[model samples]
Target: MTCRLPAALALLILPALPAGAQSLEDSAARLAELLRAGRAVISENQALINDPGLGDKGLTPEAFLSQVTAAFLARTGSPAVSEDLPPFQRALAEAQLEAMGQTIAEAQPLINMEGVGFKGFIPAVFARLANERFGELADGRAAVKITAPPELVRNRKARPDDWERAVIEDRFLSAGWTRGEAYAEETGPGFRMLIPEYYSESCLACHGSPAGETDVTGFPKEGKAAGDLGGAISITLRP
Candidate 1:
């Protein structure tokens, strides 16, 4: 739908973290905010495609994602980032770009199915598909994993990693923090990053109670309640 934020909102929302010379916390927060914002934009665009009025106006998911990718690239000014940037920061930006590109590519097939309509699918499905594909690419060089506590996972891929396991057990699941947390710490020669994700009402159909029930895609439900510590998205960067 060619979603464009108001100029004022754009100014406030699109700031990219400086490519170099920032604290780990600042860098992590910036990356988290950027990724979250990108996700929000994609979700909003998907909704527009489902809007009858917008659909009739020729808004398609592919077109909407393409525009979003372009806007994000422009906002990041990534081309200007020096090749000498810290390995973690550079890889972070690269992964973010790869993620957006993969979303646009992976969504094309689904977008083509617009003729049949996306009746059984939710926006998060597309997001997960894209992230999983990116996770494959991240192996060895960097890492991206989405996982919840063991009880909340429907499959092995969603099982918590060591860092996520600790965070969920010590913080969200135990300490009751509803908000996302971000931190970067040394891992071998580089660092690993983590961001928490909480369950919302939209997640109920798939992850909420009645444990053995199947969701729209027929995947087993996790019987989780709203606001539960659904999972975290973890990333690792290496030199």
Candidate 2:
């Protein structure tokens, strides 16, 4: 299913900004929305891999994700700036778009490696490799990670980091939020972050089941429901 940000949640997440920074905030919010949209497209398309028509096409999940990203960007007129924005806002928008593109590029290979079958060891091993390569491409300016809570994935990397644990605990675990998107400034200067991810029907194959059952990958299942939070795609930015 396509995910839509609730209006109330959107309003709550918008940062309070000074008049001078309002334009920049708007630009940032727009970029975050785009990132969320891109993720949703990937999720929905990935879920379709099992369809008779789509399955016969023989495209791997990663390849399908890349195709969807390209089509979404093209349809949305991405990399285009509003002419009315001031020079600074225009520049900020352009930079954010570039970073988003680079992040997608780096993520695609990892998703490709995981494939569609949720097979043994491939997902876990390639997920680590993807994170390593993404770290190299991010080059200290930003970081991206895909993780689930300890109860779900049972891997060290699946555990949320200090920056993320509280949010996951409160918003996802406590409140039953299946999907979320947010942007926040870090304690340090010029550092901010955006996170967007959600659960989907296909996630149930591995994550949903008897708690101790072995999945296709021989990993213990989480006994999660269809709408349970599968994991997150978190992107931290230095800009």
Ten contiguous residues with the weakest lDDT in model 1: 6-15
List clashing residue pairs in candidate 2: none
Clashes of each: 2, 0
Model 1 segments more than 4 A misplaced: 1-22, 47-91, 119-123, 132-141, 176-179
Candidate 2 — worst ten consecutive residues by lDDT sum? 1-10
Candidate 1 similarity to native, TM-score: 0.65
Clashing residue pairs in candidate 1 are 208-223, 209-223
Each model's TM-score, in the order given? 0.65, 0.54
The best candidate by TM-score is 1
